[model samples]
Target: MQNYTKFGKNININNIEIAVKTRLGQPHETMRNGVMKERKKPGLKKARKASQFSKR
Candidate 1:
């Protein structure tokens, strides 16, 4: 038997139980720590993008 804490809740798993085989999957790292947006750089159209060039 094993104990797991998920979403602030306690869960128990038995070696001989089918629930053990269908255990929950872990959340993504970003999800666990919260997602953050990248800051845009100076003198750029976007974060890492620039204006298009025109050659005539």
Candidate 2:
């Protein structure tokens, strides 16, 4: 893939500021959102409850 419009040349991206306001970063938020979504899905609760019974 061509990085620039003229030809296939690597572009300099040295000034990129990589961070988030909180310490955990955006990835943590995304993962937390996914878990929350899965918990809300149908049949998920039943499966989890079944696992709890096996731990007894």
Candidate 3:
């Protein structure tokens, strides 16, 4: 907590750290949705063998 003083007001440093990571999680979750959509596209392999034989 003491080390966080450099970022947050020295007296409230620990408080700021608490919300730092929580605020970033929202964008991460949205990126997952996009990633899942792309993975579902036919371009990606569903299995190792499926991908190898796909060209055939």
Better of 1 and 2 by TM-score: 2
Candidate 2 structure lDDT: 0.35
lDDT of each prediction vs. the true structure?
Answer: 0.33, 0.35, 0.38
Candidate 1, clashing residue pairs?
Answer: none
Per-residue lDDT tens digits for candidate 1, residues 16-40, read: 1233233443222222233322334
lDDT of each residue in 1-56, candidate 3, tens digit only? 33433433332333443433343322121223223112243445457568678878
Clash number for model 2? 0
Better of 2 and 3 by TM-score: 2
Q: Highest lDDT: give the candidate number.
A: 3
TM-score of 1: 0.19
lDDT of 2 at 41: 46
TM-score of 3: 0.21
Candidate 2, residue 36: Cα displacement in angstroms equals 9.2
RMSD of 2: 12.4
lDDT for 17 (candidate 1)? 28
